[model samples]
Target chain A: MGRQLLSILLLAPLAAILVSLASRRARIAEYATVAAAIIDLAVSIPLLLRTLSGSLIFAHGYVLLDAFGVWVILCVSIVYALSSIYAVGYMRLLNEEERLPTFYALFSGFALTMLLACVMNNAGVFWIAIELTTLVSTFLVGFEREAESTEAAWKYIVVVSGGISLALLGTVLFYWGSSFVLGPSYAMTWAALRQSAPQVYPPLLLVSFLLVLVGYGTKAGLAPMHTWLPDAHSESPAPVSAMLSGALLNASMLGIARFLGVVTGTSVSRFAHAAVVGFGIFSFVLAILFIVRQTGIKRLMAYSSVEHIGVQALGLGFGGPLGMAGALYHMLNHSLNKSLMFYGAGNAMRAYRSKEIKSIRHVLKVFPVSGILWLLGAVGIAGAPPFALFLSEFTVLRAGIGGSYRWVVIVFVIFLIIVFIGFLSHFRAMYFDEAPEGEIVPLPFTAWRTLPMWLAFLPLLVLGLWWPHGLWNIFHQVFLSVMGGGQ
Target chain B: MFLAHINSLQASIFSSLAILSLLLTFVMLGSHWLKNYVYAFAAQSWLIAALSASVGYFSGYRELYAIAVLTALFRGLVLPWLLMRIVSRLNVKREIHSVLQSSSSLVIGACVVMFAFVIANHMSRQQQGAAHVVILALTIMLSMKFLGFLMLSVRDEAVSQILALLVLENGIFLGSQILVPGMPLLIEIVILFDLLIVVACFGMLVRFLVVHAGTTSSRELNRLVG
Candidate 1:
């Protein structure tokens, strides 16, 4: 049953790619992708529920459907579904009817690679999957074919490919280290690495882990290495930006988390955690600085992505059940909330014919219902209460408070307030500030545009209000599987 | 472990091939012409393929022969061919905009090699017997990586950047051949094909860069900023 669901979950996107490519009309291609994304989301939820009871291995152990991996799959599928629906409304605005088929094809292909990256069991194969994601998404990032878009695409591929080669090297080192214990011919599976971790030389293991962290951290948009992100995210069409933030970063984080799991109980574990914490804090501080002085609206959201990814890294580096749970929860919430924010930003960009926040004024006058939802989303994403991010961020903070990095918790809280102020100030200007003596023309309302925001906003509100018991159970099981104490 | 069991002739053969490949990376770093970078890359790929086949022969890993053939066909031949096509399409021949002089960059590249050697020396100290070959492999692998990044930072042309990325992948591939020859055959093969797809994608993007951006040099492509 689990295998069937996994097959369907993967095959749906493959089928969508074929159908989209075969179709001549833009509407058919768009609808086909939306259908595929919905099917994937439907399949992934059950897969996540089923895998929580026990991990499943398939295809000679090259694919793993464990609780931790399935949770990431769930996040990817959610973003895929939301973004595809949002893309239907968003791409129509681009007026490139002839190229829409190709766009949808690459979009589904990008989704397929992120999903593939989630379930890959072999570390080497996982690197390939992540690399494939970069390859596919570079086209998507450059889909607009503008000067800036192509430049962003160039930087995205170069930086990410260079960064992940470090990950490839680290994986080789890991396999070499394990070879000393498991012979020269063993599979480089996550389980094999974990089994051989304690026996590998401490210095080798530490160096390998740090290399992998920096490599995957670059992909996941951690600071200092996040130079490509604002350019790529802000320059891509909005739905693609949504998917890049909402799906792709989480997949890369899955790689880092799994690697952390392998070295969890080793002698280098403390140093490993501290290094993660250091990167996390650095990313957080850097993002805060950028956000405060940000100009472009989507770039604001991009930097916020860096900030939240930092928080998730902080959670994972904290290394307990609570920390893991909070990080996983933050992944889902950030996906939903970031997608909502990008959709609104896309809508405003189309209506006002500008990408600057200063140009978009009186949002309630323009969008009315969805505008209110966007405003609330901005508040929610700023780590305000009655929204899901606040809950997850608070949980991550609680996880840090009693730990060795309690000082990081204090730093985390202070910046949380700063981020709250900095992020919402842009929204405040957009929503409440008067326009500079100009009549802003609003675009005609489409359910395609606002429906996903409503879909995303409702869940963000509910998940904040009620943290589900089933979710707690799933998080606990994933924590056990990732941190290595349960069967 | 594979290195420990190999005889001195095997070790020397591996060491020389590895050093030659590392020298090719230096040729890439020191040259001003984009064609030289591509040629150096092709030579380095061929040398790594030779290294892979030799490692397979000495270590008795038969699958690496297949890997060697693929690396030669794809990395040594097809990738450079594709990159050469990208270069010929562009009007710029030599790196017209230099972030650093070739002489200075080559000096920095030497320093990077020494730095990689120190790290490799530290890492290989943990291993027993035949440690020098492991150290050599690790050093070449890492130096290529550093030199690749150096090329990326110093050269503004799109083709040069693409070659730098290929150099990075070559470094990893060369290291994996020596250090983990028994890594799954499927993975190595897929990564080879994956590299082909990457270059093809880069080829298309370079076309897009030329058409849409009007310049392939990143110095002119800087429209998007925070």
Candidate 2:
């Protein structure tokens, strides 16, 4: 049953790609992508449910459907479905009817790679999958063919490819280190690495872990290495941006979390946790600084991604059931909330005919219902209460406060306030500020545009008020599988 | 295991090939012309392929023979051919906007090699009976990485940047061939094909850069700033 669900989950995107390519009409391609995405989301939920019983391995251990992997798959599928729906309205606005089929094809291909990255059981194969995501998404980032989009695509591929090559080197080092213990011909599976971790030289293990962290950190949009993220995210069409932030980053973080799992209980574990916390704190500080001074609306959202990913890093670094649970929860909430924010930004960018926050005024006047949804999403993403991000952030904070990294908890709280203030200030200007002079024309409302926002916003609100029991059970399993009972 | 038990002749053969590949990276770093960079990359790939074959012969990994052929075909022949096509399409021949002088970059590249050697020495210090070949492989692998990144940072042309990235991959491929020859053939083969796709994508993007962005140099591609 688990294997069948996994097959369907993987094949749906492939089917989408085929349908998109084969169809002559743009609407057919768009509808096909949406259908594929919904099927993937539907399949992934049950896949996660089935894996809750225990981790599932298939293809002679090349694919893993553990709770952790399935959770990321769930996040990717959610974003895929939402973005595909959003793209239907968004791409129509671009008026590139002839190019839409190709766009949908690449979009589905991009989704396929992210999903593939999640289930890769071999570390080497996982790196390849991540690399494939970069390759596929570069075109999507440059889909608009504008100067900025093309430039952003260039930088995205170069920086990410360089960074991920470091990950490749680290994986080689890991395999080499394990070879000393497991012989020269063993598979470089996560389980094999974990089994050999204690016996490998501590210094080698530490160096390998740090290299992998920095490498995958670049992909996950953790700061300093997150230079490519803002350019790529802000420049891509809004639906593609949603997928990049909401899906790709989670897949990369899955790699880091799994690597961290490999080194758990080793002598280098303490230092490893500290390094993660260091990057996390640094990213938080950097993101907050950028968030406050931001001008572009999507760029503001991009920095918030950097900030939330930092928070997730902190959760994983804190190393407990609570920390793991919070981080996983944050992944889902951030996906929903960030997608909502991007969809709103997309709507405003289209209606106002500008990408600048200063240019977009009186959002409520323009998009009465979706505008309110967007405003609440901005608040939620800013780590405000009665929204899901707040619950996850608070949970991560709870995990940190009693740990050795208690000082991080203090720093995390101070910045959460700063992020809330900095992020919402832009929204405040957009929502409540009076419109400049002439009347701005609003685009006609379409369910294709606002439906995803409503779908995303409701979940963000409910998850914040009440954490589900089943989710807690899933998180517990993830915590055990990833933390290896060390905490 | 391969490195630890290698005889002196095998050790010398591996070290020479590794050092020669590192030299080609320096050639890439010191050159002003984009074509020079591509040729240097091609040479380096061939050397690494040779090293892969030698390692296979010495270590008895029969699958690496196929890997060596693919590396030579794809990395050595096909990638450089694709890169040359990208270069010929562009009007700019040399890095018209040099971020650093070739001589200065060469000096910095030397420093990077020394730093890499120190790190490699420290890393391999724990292995009992570890050969100097092990240290040499680690150092050349790491040094090529640093030099590749240096090339990436200092070069502005799109083709140069692409070559720098290929150099980075080559460094990792070289390291893996020596350090973990028994890594599954499937992964090695997939990674080779993946690099092909990457270059093809880069070729298309370079054309996009020229037609849409008006320049292949990153200096002019900075329209999307914070």
Candidate 3:
């Protein structure tokens, strides 16, 4: 049953890609896309339920399904579903219906590659899947066919492909490092590799993990390796931008987390922890610095992504039940809040006909619903109460202090405060400032367009105030998986 | 006894081919003509294919031979043809626009090769079975990978950047030859497929740049900044 559902989740998108491509009408392609997303969400919910009951491993270890993998699939499908709906209004507003086939095709392909990256059992296949995500999204990034968009796509493809190739080298080295212990029977399968990791040579494993960290870390928008993040995130269409931030980064992080999971019992884990923690803190600092200076609203959201990704990496690196669980939980919260923010930014872009935060003013007066949602999203992502992000960030902070990383915790808090202030100041100018002189702006709002934002934001509110038992149980299992305890 | 003799014969051929390919990479790095760059890359791919075939002969792994054929078909012939078409489509004059003079670039390349040799020596001391030469191949690829990086940063043409990325991938492939000769065929296929897609995308990007911006130099791509 699990295998059947897995096949559906993986293959449905491919089928949609084909059907969308063959269709001539934009409406047909859009409907196909939304249907595929619905199928994805429908299939994954049951899969998550089953995974919570017990882990599912199939194809002789090619695909492993635990609560964590299911949780990621659920997040990805939810975002993709919302994005598909939002893309309807976004494309029609721009009158880009002629390009719908290509957009929908690549969108489906992008979602498929991300899903594959989450569940693939082999490290080599996982790396390939992540690389494929870049390939698909590059075209989507360049969908505007404008000079800046094309340039952004070019930079994104070149930088990310280069990074993933390094990760590929690391995967090869990992296979070599473990061949001594595993006797070359299983190749690079994660389950087999993890079983043999304890006996693998520490030097070789350390080298592989470092390479993997830098390699996948680039995809995850880790600082110092994230030069492409802002450009790609801001240039792509809003739906693509949302998926890149919300789903794709998490997929790459999942790859890194799994590698760390494999190395948990080994001596090299300390090395991995230090690297993750260092990169996380560095990214957080850089994000705060960049956030304060950004004028483009999408670019601001992109920097915030870097900062939140840093938080997750730091949580994972903190390496305890509280930290790891909080990291996983934060992944969920960050995906929801960040995607919602991008949708808001999209609304602002449509209304102002520009992405510059300084261009448009009186957002609250012009489009009250989107304006409120946008402001609330900013407050929500800033780690305010009544949002899941606040709970997750607090949990992570507690874990860090409890784990005796006092200095790091202090810096973390300082950076968080700075970023929170950064968010408020940037949006304050956008929301309350007067409009540019004699400039008239048209309002582009509809119930259908704004519905997805409210749909996504409600969960953030619900998850923040209430932690249901089933959800907590699943989070506990995922934490155990991260700690290398559960299957 | 027969197998032993065949192994030595195979080893000599492999060594000679690897060395020749390494030498051709220098020609690639120093060439001022884009056509020469393409030819040098194609020749290097052919040599890698031959070397893989010999590795198969010596190790008795049939999959390596298939890898060799795929390399010849895709890297050696198809990719070069695709690149040549892109060159003509862009109407690129046969001139390389690099930041450094030829003499200095060549000198830097030589220094990098020596640096790679030293690292390879250190690594080979801990491994086995002519793996030192393999590591030598690996380091040469690494240095050339740096050369690719140099080309990317120093050259003005978008096509040069594309060729430089191909150089980086070739370096990675060469390193894999020595690092894990027993890598799965499935992985090799996927890597090749990825290369094909990247090339296609690179060609499309170059064409787009030329059509829209009237130049293929990435230096003009500065509209997006902090």
Candidate 4:
């Protein structure tokens, strides 16, 4: 059953993507995504239950049948399933006969790459998978096919391609350094590299950490190199923007976690930790500045992505159990809140044909469900109490302050406050003003569109309210694995 | 010190030739005609390819020799030839408008070269034979970046910007070969593939700019600025 499920998990999305290409209508392709997602979830369910029973499943050398990847893959598949259902309702409203099908095709293809990036055993293949995510998403950024979107696509293409190139270079460099350890057995697999890492050249490893930090961190949209984030996120389709903010960024973070694990070993771990923390503080500072100045609703959310990613980076930089858990938890919450924000943006624009903050007035009046979701999303991201983001974010901040990184905690609090004020101003105007003049009628609001959002949000609610049994242990194993936990 | 001298001498000759091509950045600022700018770019590539060949021959790295020849053929000849056709057929005159003053840009070019030389000197002290090579190559990269930035700053011509960008890419390939030798063949091939596709994309972008905007200038691209 495990072997069969693994093949299905790998092949199902590719099959859906291939079928999506031979047609103009997306109904069949969207259904295929839903089917694939459900099947994948079903397949992963057993892995989760078995992991709980203290048994591990391994597919290939690189593919570890561990609790960490199983949980990530399962969560990704579930969210994807929900998003697929929503896409059916979403695409029914689009008039681009040729493009809508292509959109669905790329969407499914993105799911395949993300899932592959999740479960792949070799860290090198994992980097390639992350690069594939950018390559596929470039089209999604320019789906509107306008000049502005073209510029946005170029921004995404150039920055991300440049970033990933550095990552590839870093991976190869690591191979050169690690070849000293595994000799002819060097496979570029995570397990091998970690096991043989003590012999890893320290100076060379330092350089590798720098390269990976800049490379993967750029994709993760850390500041100083995150110039492309706002343009690409704000310009892409709402759902695509949601996925980018939600899952893609997390995937890149996972790449960084792997880099830290391999490079640091059990020793000082100083270089990787210092560099990531610096990047985190820098991102937090810049995200607040950009968020306040932004006029586009989607751009505001993109900058928010930068800020939240900073929290995750801070957690990883700290490298303690609490910090690691908080970082992982924030990954889940970020996907939920950011995707929800973009859905509201999508629905708002569908009704108003504009993303301008001033033009999207009275969202609640026109699309009641999306309006409330948008409000909740805004509140959540601003780290308002009771929302899931508040919990994860608070833990991150607590970790920082408790660890005596007072500066990081202070800067974080300040940035969160600035973004909160900015969101309030925009959120107030969006819900209270007169219905946008000349707002479009008959926008698509399929019940399926709401499923992914709800699925994403549900975990946030559950995690925030109660400490789920076994989650902590899974988090511990994953964290330790990153910190070279268990051999 | 003897080993260092040889490296410095090698780097000096290459950098001097590179500085000679820094003239092209000025030409970009001062020149009016698109033809002259493309000519300046062509001359820069020719110098770059030649310099790369000499560096490879001196270092005895045969693969770099192959890369150098490829650089000369594709960048020196192919890219310039392509740009010539793109401009002449597009019917845009050679006397294109620019963003900064030719004199000022020339000054900036000199500064960038100075910075590159200093950086090259410091960098050369680290690697056995490749330090000067690395520094000059990095300067060439900065020069390319400066040239592209200048184009982006002043002129609104999308075609010119894209052309300058390809030239800039030539500078990057030049540097990468010098600082990072012994890389896996796969990476080398991937970089080459990436550069080729990017150039083709630039070509397509130029064609589209001409078709849709009626001119390849960014002034016409004012449709999306915010």
TM-score of each: 0.99, 0.99, 0.95, 0.79
For model 2, how does the per-residue alpha-carbon lDDT over A80-159 read when each residue is reduced to its tens digit?
Answer: 99999999999999989999999999999999999998999999999999999999999999999999999999999999
* Prediction 3 global C-alpha lDDT: 0.82
Tell me, what's the RMSD of every candidate? 1.3, 1.0, 2.7, 5.4
Identify the runs in model 3 with alpha carbons over 4 angstroms from their true place. B1-15, B94-97, B110-131
Score each candidate by Cα lDDT.
0.91, 0.92, 0.82, 0.69
| lDDT, residue A117, model 4 | 84
Q: Provide the lowest-lDDT 10-residue window in model 3 chain B.
A: B1-10
Best-to-worst TM-score order: 2, 1, 3, 4
Which residue pairs in model 2 clash with each other?
none
Docking class of 1: high
Q: Where in model 1 is the C-alpha error above 4 Å?
A: B126-128
Ranking by lDDT: 2, 1, 3, 4
DockQ of each: 0.82, 0.86, 0.43, 0.12
- The value of fnat for model 2 is 0.85
lDDT of 4 by residue, B1-226 (tens): 2123355677777778766766666676567677887888778777767766775677555566666666677777777787777777777785345556666766766676676556435423344564454456556654555555555456665556655555555555555444443433444444455555555655655664454445566555443322
In terms of DockQ, which candidate is strongest? 2
lDDT of 2 by residue, B77-169 (tens): 999999888888786789877889999999999999999999888777534544588888899889989998998999898999999999999
For residues B1-226, write the lDDT of model 1, one tens digit per residue: 6777767898899999999998888888888898998899999999989999999998899999999999999999999899888888886789878988889998999999999999888876534557888898899989998999999999899999999999998998988888888888988999999999999999999999989998888888778777
What TM value does chain A in model 4 reach?
0.93
Ordered from best to worst DockQ, the candidate numbers read 2, 1, 3, 4
**lDDT (10s digit) by residue, model 1, range A259-349:** 9999999999889989988999899989999999998999999999999999999989987989998999999999999999999999999
